[model samples]
Target: MKIGLYFGTFNPIHIGHLIIANHMVEYSDLDQIWMVVTPHNPLKKKDTLLDDYQRLYLVNLATEEYPKIKPSDVEFKLPQPNYTVNTLAYLQDKFRQHDFSLIMGEDNLKSLHKWKNYEVILQNHDIYIYPRVSPEIENLELKNHSKIHIIDAPIVEISSTFIRENIKSKKNIQPLLPCKVWEYIDHNNFYRK
Candidate 1:
């Protein structure tokens, strides 16, 4: 099986995330798209970030109906301050029969070169890039790399930060989130500080 790892904090999973994950699984060769809920680094202050399990639950709620997309808490099990390259290595070791790749936005592609062991990641796995409205230019070296594939997915501008801010302001951000996710957040009064 070909699995695409889509990493994010997903403090609260939203429609934009679902759209991209769905589009990748449907449009690309990936058999599954794992929405890897990134764990918060212990070194950083946990100001606006929700509890790890809460974020994972939100991801689960958001992706439960999608057959091809599922939520993963792999990073939660790994050592803190984990890097993508390490996760890829671990996943590859654990799931030897399956092929793994990355799913990221074009904006992330711009800063790919700065990531730890980025060259190793490029050599070992393919990267699927979704469009994002960003003013920064992508790295010239990676722009034409054979391991990187540009996917013509829809440009979703909605963000978890935006949704959280709206909820805090007592605005109806229902349209931005999945039904179950919205219910969970509303019931729990998340981000309403």
Candidate 2:
């Protein structure tokens, strides 16, 4: 089976995320799009992120309706400062028969060179990149071996940081996240400073 691993710190999974996951399964050959909820990403600022379990729960709520979608907590038990290459390697070993590929935004594609084991990741798996409008993906110095596919998805500018700040300000974040997730966040007073 072709699995697309969409990794993110789903501080709270929002509609924009749902749209992309749906698009990947609806349009691509991918049999499933696993929302690999990362506990800690080595490249990001730690302070701004929500607790790993909370984020995973929100993603689970958001993706529950789609059988093709699964909210994965695979990275939580793994070592902190999680690197993509390591996570990919681990998942590959665990699910030996399944074909795993990376799902990311065009913005990440721009900084592909900086990721741990960039060349190896390129050589081993396919990357399904969705557009991140602000950062237009102009041609980077192309590596000869990588397999990259660009996907045109509805460009939603909603960022987790912005949602967190909005919740902190007691602003209505209902439109940003799914109803179930919003309810959970409100009940738990998540992201409130």
Candidate 3:
């Protein structure tokens, strides 16, 4: 099984996220795309983030209908501030029968070197970079590497932070989120100030 791991905080899984994951399966060589819900991203600030399980639940709700996409809580059991190299290593070890690829945005390519054992990550797994409105990959070190596959997936300009702000201000986020996810947020009263 060839799987693409699309890791994110997923504060509330939105349609844009589903769009990218679905596109990965349809356009890329991977058989499945797993939305790896990160408990804590080493590079990001954790303040104001939703509980890991709630975020995971939202992701599950948003992705449940997509046969090609699935939600993963793999990072929940791992140590805090999980490193990509370690998570990838763990996944590779447990799923020996499956080939794993890292799914990321074009913007991440520029900061690859800042990641822990980033070189090892590149050496072991292929990286599928979906396009973002941000500037192109400026990191020339690995620009031409065969392991880096840059793909033009459909871009969604909206972000989770924007959705959270809108919710806090009592604005409707139906257009930004999947119906089920919006319903879940409504039921749970998430992201309110």
Candidate 4:
């Protein structure tokens, strides 16, 4: 099976995420999309994030109805400060029958060189890039690599940060989130200071 791993904090899983994952699975050659929930990202601030399980739960809630998309907690079992390369190595070992690829935005591609052992990731797995509203230029060599595929997915502008900020401000951000996720956040009073 060919799986595209879509890694994110998923502070709260929203519609934009679903749209991208669905698009990738249906529009591309990938058989499934795994929404990998990171326990801790080296580049992001841990203090601002909700509990890891809470975010994972939201991902579950958001993805339950989509058969092609599923939530993954693979990063939780591994050490903290998760790196894509390590997770990929573990998954490759465990699921020897599956061919794993990366699902990322154009912005992330621009900064791929900074990731730990990024060259290994590029060499072993194919990377599926989705469109993002990023102005930064990507490394030409990396962008044009045979293993890198720039998918013509929709340019989703919605972000978890935007959703969180609106929720904190008591704005009606229900449309931005999955119905179940929005309901859970409202009941639990998440992101509301």
Candidate 5:
């Protein structure tokens, strides 16, 4: 089976995430999209990030309805400062029967040259890039690479940062979150300052 690994912190999974996962499964060659919930991103600040387990739980709640798109806590058991290269290598070793690909945005592709062993990643696996609002990644050098596939997926403008800000101000974030996830966040008072 072909699997696409969509790695993210998932501080709170939102509609945009769901839309992309659904699109990857339905429109792309990916048989499944595993939402790899990273516990700690090497490049991001952790102050605003929810606890790893909580973020993983929210991801699970948000993706529960989609069988093809599920939450993966694989990083939680791995080392800190989770890097995509390490996770990909570990997963490849463990799930040899499945073909794994990386799912990311054009923005990430623009900065991928800075990632650990990026050249190795490009040579070994295909990347499914989705459109982002940013214009900077439009001129990426790797755009023409045979391993790069631009997916015409639905683009949702929502971001986890926006949802967290709204929650902090006691605003209704229901529109951006799945119903069960919204309820869980509401009941647990997550992302409150």
Candidate 6:
């Protein structure tokens, strides 16, 4: 099976996330995409973050309707301050029958070298980059981008941190998250400052 691994903290999954995953299946050769909910991202601050399981559950609830998209706790069981290289390594070992690809944003392209074992990850896996609004990849970058496929995904500015902070401030976040995720956040009284 060819799988696109779109890893994120999720915090709470939203429509923008779903759209990208759906687009991956519709436009790409990948059979399925596993929304690998990272328990901890090495680059992100965790002070405002919710419990990993709650975030994972929200991911599950938000993505339940899409057969090709799945919510995963794969990173939950992995080591702390999760890095892509490690997750990929673990997944490769566990699901030997499957081939994996990396799914990420265009901005991430500039920082790929900063990631752990980035060279190995780049060489071993196919990368699918969904473009953001800022810039287009130039030809020189294209040579480097050859190992990565760029797709123009819908650019919604919604962010999990923004949503979390909005909830804490008791601001309306109805437009940021899926209805089910919003309900879950409200029910759990999450982010109440």
User: Each prediction's Cα lDDT score?
Assistant: 0.92, 0.85, 0.87, 0.91, 0.89, 0.83
Q: Candidate 6 on 1-193: residue-level lDDT in tens?
A: 9999998878777778888899988899889999988775656777877788888899888888889988888887887877789999999999999999989887887778788988899888999988777655563253265678887677767777788788888898887777888898898898786
TM-score of each: 0.97, 0.91, 0.93, 0.94, 0.94, 0.90
**lDDT tens digits, residues 1-193, model 1?**
9999999999888899999999999999999999999999989998889999999999988888998999999999999789999999999999999999999998889889999999999999999999988755453568699999999899999998888899999999998898999988899988999
Count of steric clashes across candidates, in order: 0, 0, 0, 0, 0, 0
Cα error, residue 151 of model 1, in Å, equals 0.4
Worst window of 10 by summed lDDT in candidate 2: 137-146
**Per-residue lDDT tens digits of candidate 5, residues 157-188?**
89999999999998887988999999998898
Q: Which candidate do you rate higher for TM-score, 1 or 3?
A: 1
Who wins the TM-score comparison? 1
lDDT of 2 at 24: 89
Q: Can you write out model 3's per-residue Cα lDDT over 129-167, one digit (the tens) per residue?
A: 888877556545676888998887888787999999999
How does model 2 fare in lDDT? 0.85
Q: What lDDT tens digits, residue by residue, belong to model 4 across residues 115-192?
A: 999999999999999988775545356889989999989999999999989998989999999899999999999999
Clashing pairs in 1: none
Ranking by lDDT: 1, 4, 5, 3, 2, 6
Candidate 4, residue 120: the lDDT equals: 98
Candidate 1's displacement at residue 1, Å, is 0.5
Worst 10 residues of 6 by lDDT: 135-144
**lDDT of prediction 1:** 0.92
Q: Pick the candidate with the highest lDDT.
A: 1
> Which prediction has more favorable lDDT, 1 or 5?
1
